[model samples]
Target: MNAELVEQYRLLHERRPDYGSGASHVERIAAIIERRGVRSVLDFGCGKGALVERLRARFPEVVVDGYDPAIRGRERIPLERYQMGYEMVIANDVLEHLDAEGYGEDLLEMGRLEPRWLFFNISCRPAVNVLPNGVNCHTLVRRPEWWREVLLACFPGFIEHGSEWNERSKGWMLAMTRPLELEGRRVAIVGNAPQAMGNREDVDGFDCVVRFNNFVVGDGYEAVGTRTDVLAIPACNRAVITPRLKRFTEGVSYVLDLATAGCVQAKANHGKIRQLLPHATIV
Candidate 1:
């Protein structure tokens, strides 16, 4: 933990003492733990130890611990009390509070814990709570995509569960889980061009067959192949890709480029495709 960053939070907490009420948030988190069969959890920035108490009360069999630098003496237990390598590590409403310089360090510390699953509930908007200087408690408010980018930098292989809206709390929650590796796996990339017309047998011979944007199989199943292990789509080709995706690509691994794969007019396509493909890994 950075001493300067800790001091900053300590001062912020002194100014806005009641800024850490996350009881409703705890309920949602607990539900996830139960559904996912998570036996152990470490609440990284457990404000006031609210979630820790609730987890123990609701699920006595499960092990839960908390760490909060700001409220450690008063409401939270010290960081040293908890052991590393929890089944899940949660940092609810915490990332947005860090200073610019401390953000990467904080994320690194969370990564060092080496949890199987990591949950982050970050407030992208301004907080209701204000400091003595009249600044919002959320100092590092950013768009969901920006947060995802920062997270990917720290954990590249992890599978992301994109920003999902919580109707109960009216907030967004982001999650990522460590994925099983596929080392030296043979995969055939089948494009939508005419060359892939009669190569079904060769394509299907591989362990997995990957299809490119807006591909068809029903027309020539014998020639084009029926199996689609993965779908690779460019960011700007949404008009041709969106409807096909909804109709066919459930449970399919989608590989998408963040920018225009080939060429597009607009610098940024402010369309529904961006929201639809939120969890896509940037190529």
Candidate 2:
């Protein structure tokens, strides 16, 4: 990102309160990424520049820049005059806000940056029939498959080799592994889909193969079970967002005594999100 644009992204993050309490989501993501020896990255939707701060703290010398169209703060990057590409891209909780202008043009613009790998997270609901929760502040709730098709077509050389999704969040969390080879590659969920968590019919378990299974029933996803033959990931897609590893990450997690899952705890990892998210569990 150019210096001015980077300034704009940072500006927006300044207003939002530090919300993603706990769960080491940032570090766990960094841990999975540290293995790559990343040099530079584009932290898309870098709210408060918090995640970028964590990435910098952990990776040390890695060059990390960010962008967010919503920000208008003093410490943010404007993103208008930015001119550069990145080796890696980090865009957590960014998809739900995308328009054809953002995901389409913005990505094509970023693609020119030539990022070898992208670390992104999107809004998702469990195939387990969870809850109607998108209204919670920042989630845009797009189809997980749409993400795969766009990314795959953009970066045809890579594949999501192994990823974990927190079934409870219904959100797909993953590590997009660089593609080794993509000749007729296929992926499928190996076990029985998780039982739906509650009664919201639209909210199903994270076994996205069920999402595609909907293709056979009609246009709209009829019911989770009606679409079975389709895999959790797209035929071209090679991943399933699973949970993160708790201990494998750089820091230790802490918890509170209350039964309610929403609680905040801090860690040495250099960012606010190091605080845990309620009901957040490691895969």
Candidate 3:
């Protein structure tokens, strides 16, 4: 922890300690926890323990804990309490308080908590609140992209939910979760076009080639290459599913678009197509 930054926060807390009255912030986080099925949560830099209390009251089953270095008494708790990890780690309006010099270290420390999902509500703009020295309480104010880059560097494996501006909070809330690695090694989406013919070598190089509905292969084998890893069938083309098309799907993985799966299943050649690719994954 940066001593100087800590002192800045301590001074800021003296002036404006409470997070103010509003269940919107707490409710949003609660909704995420329920949606993600997060059983445990650690609210880092939880000011006044408002969110901690709200989460506890809202979700009795979930194990909710909070720690804030700046706040005193019950609001401030030891970090050692959550050494193992939590299902989700929330750092709402906390990162901006730290100095730019110690920002990376602060993020690294948060990463060490080893949460499956990280919900970061970062304030990109300057804060209305200020420290005793008249300096803005948000010391390390940065754009959402800058925060995204830093977060990704600290936690590489987590899949980022695109940054969205929240009008109510006037900040960017970034949600990242551990992704399902169902898609194998390398994936190249092959579009059905003339350009795809010229890009055969590039397409063939990928571990999986995702081709769209009724894609031609035999006629343009030399140009398009002979590797069909996954075939995507769109519902609009279900009427055109012929015997030749069923044969075209031989020995290839199938990616059925749910909207079109019902239509595709209704086709005469659907049985043969199903027989060819016994296990088809729906997208």
Candidate 4:
């Protein structure tokens, strides 16, 4: 957030009380609260804190807090702590007003708070009001696709539950859930530890089984079951790993190469791996 831009917004909020109001997203956010059973909600970039009062009135059981750099009380919370344990975080009609350079940083900061869900309402078109400096209020107006890329980069593995472009507001409303595809399922991430020596029945009973790099299962079958639904392996040294992989290719459907960070050899290794494990998908 730019200091000068924040000062301009602060002045605007004082002059026009309805300038940063987030009443438009009240119903949308309230629906999430009711559906997800969210105990607490932190309204990121809340203007005038109007949404705070409205949400509390609607869902008295849910704790709602607002944070805005331009707002006096709200400004202090974001600066003091990054690990706010809110179940849901909402930013409505707020990203457009911020500087383009600082947008990623702001999104990353919001992610650091670690909310279970993130709700974004971004205006892709120009704002109705102008700034104190004789400029459009919507400083960074980009298409919905551009905004989606930014949000996805910050919150990886978060599945998009709902998304739609609202012609009425000339913006996009997106609801994303963190830790994708794990809800209401029995998932067992079996590790290659000595403690996992006598739990084959319990391990294989899970709906999904995830195992890490180079897990053992021949003589050690009793310890770590024969089920390898999802195998996560390091991308390095495929030549050494191929022999072991050939031995345990059965029931292994997906192989996640985790050490592929700037390693050019990892992409080349994927082809060799595909031939070795014909049944499994190499990622």
TM-score of candidate 2 against the unseen true structure? 0.49
| Best first by lDDT, ranked | 4, 3, 1, 2
Q: Distance from true position, residue 253, model 1, in Å?
A: 16
The reply for model 4, stretches above 4 Å from the true place, is 78-84, 180-283
lDDT tens string, model 2, 142-242? 56676777776876555553445666676665445443222343322223333432223532243222122112322342443232322222222222211
Between the candidate structures 1 and 4, which one is better when assessed by TM-score?
4
Model 1: per-residue Cα lDDT over 46-96, one tens digit each: 877777888889989988887787775644433453444677889888888
Residue 55, candidate 3: C-alpha displacement in angstroms:
0.4
Candidate 2, overall lDDT?
0.46
Model 2, runs deviating above 4 Å: 1-16, 19-24, 73-84, 100-102, 125-139, 180-283
Judged by lDDT against the true structure, how good is candidate 4? 0.75
Model 1 scores a TM of 0.58
Q: Of the candidates numbered 1 and 3, which has the greater TM-score value? A: 3
RMSD of 3: 13.9
lDDT of 4 by residue, 118-162 (tens): 998889999889988888999999999988888888897565556
lDDT string, candidate 3, 1-283, tens digits: 4777677777666776464222236766776687557898888888777788889998999989877777676344344655667878888878887777877877877777778888888888888877777787788888887888889888977756435687776699887766433444566666677777676465677665667777787674666655775565655665565345766665453334424445655563454333333343433
RMSD of each: 8.1, 18.8, 13.9, 12.3
Model 1, position 157, has a per-residue lDDT of: 54
